[model samples]
Target: MATTTFSKLVVFAALVFVGQAALITKPEGPTIRTRHGDVRGMYAEEGAIFLGLPFGNPPVGELRWKPPRAYNKSWAPEVRDGTVPGPACRQPGCGPNKIDYRHTCNRDKNRTQSEDCLYLNVFVPRSVLLNSSLRLPVICWFHGGHYMYGTGSAMVYDGRILANKTNTVVVTTNYRLGVFGYLVTGEGEDDARGNYGTLDQIETLKWVQQNIADFGGAKDKVTVFGQSAGSDSISVLLTTDKTTDLFHQAIMLSVPFSITHKTQLEAIRVGNDVAKSVNCSAGDMKCLRSKPADDLIVAQNEAGKYIANPFKPLELFMQWGPTVDGDILPRQTVDSFANGKIQKKPFIIGNVREEAVLYIYEAFSKPMSKLELDGIMLAFLHGKGPVALHEYNPPKASDYRPFLSHFATDWVFQCPTRNVIRNAVVNGENDVWLYVFDHVVSIKSIWHHKAYCQDHVCHGEDIPFVFQTPLLLNLSFTREEQVIADTMAYHYGNFAHTGDPNKASPNVYTTGNVLKSPLDWPRYNKRNLFPNMNFTTPQSVIVKDYNKEKCDFWDKENIYSARNKGK
Candidate 1:
């Protein structure tokens, strides 16, 4: 059900869309002549907002499971309406009985869902829009939902505050999700070889390159940034030359690097499970496409139960994702980074402190027993479990949930992130910086249902601060929280303007209230004990080799799927 305020917002959007039907030579609000048409957007206190702009044609019917086609049709004579966001791409609800606030089902309630969802939203600051001659750096955001659920235009990712504070044109886009986006059959030409979502991202970058200049954004100064699955997509973008000309720099938040991308056969195994659930034969593209979207969603849920990634059991939680299709993604992400096959673009990559707490709680209803912990270690770490359990050193008799949570955090997010950084730097990829988001958000309502995340700096905790959307949610930020948000936006804004996060470009504007980092971040290197920026309260400072011993153990174990498995 939609809230009264949201219902009113929708009514207002409809009137605005209908009212601006005809083309006016000089409209009142901020107008931009895009390649598709002349789009008229609304003006707010912060800046101009252009929502629901199509970057690619609707991926429906024959287009399902195919690469996105650029939205080439023109709405010139009839002005294209950019008032409200386009419908979120088709996706499933949250975990079975669990109330995960992050899922698209909960976040995008009462909002339309459709296959015609390849739309992107643009947010430009009032100052930047007022000066027709000024072209600021652009930041393109990719929302994350484990590549299964999430939309770019959700209130949580409202780019207005970030755009105003960063002084950059912010773009949030929607791509296909679930089986519709990443179901793979086989290596045949007719097969839906996965990574359609990745292709959609590529098409988005191409569109930005062609049309961002009209919205006061420099195409050459584009920076791609995202969290979780979005970050995973950006990491893939960094490896392939397909995105070489699309973006200049990248910012990856909470990338699940340890959940190794599925091999072609592995993807096909899951695809077949989804197909069988719907009574369709494997590799039957026509049959799969003919089925209703609802059927596919249900099938996707059922498929997770039938298959598992033996090398990485955690993958069963996030089953539908990009596949190593040999074409789009030639090799695994870490392998590419380790072998120097990746583009040497400037990037900042990091993760939250207690990334796996929520996930751990969700996986276990109550505190885990020592036996369960031993089983987890054996299942996740293989022969390396005994050595790892010795290193982690959990209490034998008491509940081991905390130990499991910390271990999962280190094994899944923190250690893998450090591994990627180490690989990138060792392979001569410079201009890289690292950080750890250690502050827990003050707003408890965001995770009200998930009580375990109340005090932990869990996954997705940094999003509200990064976009500064607490005010939009009818909530307020504490003084310390506000400072942290300001500091993050400050560094991110500087990074978008200049390759270095500490330095701001002359072209970009900075306000008197903009917060600065307590210390200058140093380039990540093998020497100097690998310093990383610890983004925390009153002041964010540089820390040396966070969880160094734990990461060393994981690295030495050589258990990560892609490690020591040569390309």
Candidate 2:
């Protein structure tokens, strides 16, 4: 009798173990259905990631230089793999895959890339698949590489961590670049029409609107964010009606507003120069289109060097960018905003305190003398070098590069951005918030620290902290740096959910992270001139106009006029 009882007890224990095992589910990739078909995406503890999804048809062969063709969805209900990443658009100086992304793009490397690279990646919370009803905010980040370099798939921009941390859907998209995307020949249809890249961005946003709901994203709550050239594109979109109903708010970082959209005539001259360099007959659109892609890219590299600022000495800036067609762009960015063509939405635009240091620091062998600084400043300030020099006499730092960095930062980034926001505020448009990133880390400490930023925060330094990519990359982050990463992500996530960046609640991302400050970020006002946020370690503070005297001089003197710069 005892042996029979023991046998029954053992069988009952085995059943209980099996039942518990069934309750603990294993991790498996999820599949979502779209208009085309179903796509299987990778699932991790971080988020559900869908990668390498093409939103536009291949813009190759005859479709080159045209607006993004519609995506062909002629598939049955079979599942496609979204685990692999797509190739980045063809451009020089792009770095290798899965390693360091901020390096030179195609520097003597046999990297995997091609012209057919207009794709995007999406990331959502891991639990969204289980709870299909959970609708989250969306963030579409436009990768910035001077509009000529970079891929949305750079590991640093992988959206899994950001999505899981913020409880939002994050998107990174690829657009055409350089001559392939922006080469303009005065003629419209058969030849190069400009703004194809911007159009590509718009198309991606449209796709997000149409399909993001299936992936649990709030279609109406989409926000577009970018750095550098991406910000410039956002600035252009703000003035145009092309992006209506696609995205609601914007976050622009380090907007170089001084680079106005080129008019058709101005663009024609530049385009003609590129054509001539490629050995094509004048107005022979057929011959230009027939050339191989690489040959055209080489031609652009050879002749794309002579773009000049008539009033200044800045060269090789934006030769091929947003062109102001009479129909699309209509006019330069500032004119459109001043005429109240702005879409009237909440925005955040800012720049680093030392914006230009990263560009000029390594080019110099010795300390940059004041005379040399004045020479460089002339390129940006034009004939107003002396006036600016008198106003921003470099403080006695241990090094002199900061002075040169300061001069260009003010004219190109700081002052112009301030003027742009001021126009919005004075017009009684939607809210405008300003910030200046003053955070700095030591080169002796952080891995992959560029020689350009020794003790200073160069341009786009806020990206890593905001995305928390350093953690994803396993780079060492001190306690303070970790806090900074948390703070930026929290505020940015807040902005995507609500228009306000600092209306913070609990920090579900980290135990120690908290964002509700004693004071809310004051909006930009013309009368009282309230202070702006200073993003730094220990804690950020509000400060009244940084380099106020110089910014005032630049605005009052009208030194930033595109007419003077030969726009």
Candidate 3:
């Protein structure tokens, strides 16, 4: 209670776990000795990239559907080659919202996918080798896929630019997905309990605490970050007391606060449906386990038909993800933040201006009429349809499904997250920075997505700029795009370095006057009406309550809390 708002409950977990590391001579020639084993990484212009480092043992055979086991470091090989990315956990190859890392943009389909995919990648700045006393901050990224697809190994998630530009270690980790990750037998702790992915993330963070120091990262300065499902996972981690020792700060980007964590019974029912789909009895644990991974994957996809009711008014979220088990996540995520049960730590939580454009663009066969838009608002809010329609009014209908996406975006993503941020700052005395990403990148043209953007910025448009991946990957970016990218990297680097994004501490980028209004990012406390930074190119300005009226309307109707109980 006596500590400042920036941090509290600082960890000694790294000290206790890393006692033996100071005893061993650090590895030579771009290699580092982890508590588990020695890993040799490849050098890059930005930093040293250590790829496919298994943080957990393969979740294969008997280990499937169980809590992740620490990577068996006692292997015969003392030195592990970490240049190649580990196989992505077994997943359905292609879908509307999915990106097959192997065949993205219709590239080669040669990359492998497997159940034995519990690995992570680390990117450390090359400069770290010069100073043995220097300990840099770390940003551990969790890739988003509705908690059902994608991997850390994906090309867009390459951590090189972020590490090099930010002067901090960047880690991207892979966790189980879909039925493989979230299945529960309702058999309690002994059998298949859901949250394997969340547990894997916790284990992977533990691994980071033990080994990151060898790669020039400070274990105590680890900040876990993610977008979408990954952000949702961080939202869960904030609620769980067990993960307190693994992280110091947080950066959540566009959390779908409306998404519900599955109840134990709901998860068990879904698992039962999976078992039945695979021709195994509800209680046939062995049969389910023995089934081929691909068969299980198919069954998993098939099981979704039952969980999400298309005939129903709306299906706003994924059916499989973090479950509220008694162990890992004991309570609803939003409820935890609302009740002030979350750890009081600095946080940066923000959403995009158009978070739901892609959803509307992809799912709809034709553009919605104004009448249809009103119907959706009604369905999403149940009997409060007229009120929502009145609040989210659009005068003359545009070519696009004008108001539908806006309504869905605020209802599902923006407002609820804002609630958590304000709650943390106002109630728990935590420093919370808010932002709205309004930048539109040209990389969208290169992507194979069905969506188009003349003025719209889709969900995750902020990422390429954050990492400067387009420049690194040889994808073309306009001169302005590069500048915006630098601006983003500077802010993110500053945040990773010091808990505050506005203050550049250990990580400094001299962008003097290049960015308009490149100054203080005000905290969303009780004061100042919670003004937010609008992250667009050229200049980033502060806006008061960014989407105040819409968010307030939802708050008045209790839309945010209602979704937690709905699905």
TM-score top scorer: 1
Candidate 3 yields a Cα-based lDDT of 0.74
Q: Ten-residue segment with the worst summed lDDT in candidate 2? A: 1-10
- What is candidate 2's lDDT per residue for 1-567, written digit by digit as tens? 111133432333344335552444533456777887778777555656888888898878777788898687646556778787777888875535534444323222344577787888899764464456777889999878777877787766777777766778899888998887887886745767788998899999999998898788989999899998888888888878888788999999988777666767666777777788878875567887788878877877875666533543343566667888865576778766666778889898898878878766755657876567667666556566667677776765555776676766787789888888888877777577888888885323332546657677877777776676666655656676776666667667778888788666342354245443344667777454646778777777777776677788888766666655622
Model 2 TM-score, 2 decimals? 0.88
Residue 105 lDDT (model 1): 42
Q: For candidate 1, list the clashing residue pairs, or say none.
A: none
**TM-score versus the correct structure, for each prediction:** 0.92, 0.88, 0.88
lDDT of each: 0.82, 0.73, 0.74
Cα lDDT of model 3 by residue, 382-444, tens digit? 667676677766776644465677777888888987887877775765568898888776665
Error of 2 at 259 (Å): 2.7
Model 2 ranges with Cα > 4 A deviation: 1-26, 95-111, 312-315, 362-371, 394-400, 442-449, 505-508, 511-519, 526-528
Prediction 2 global C-alpha lDDT? 0.73
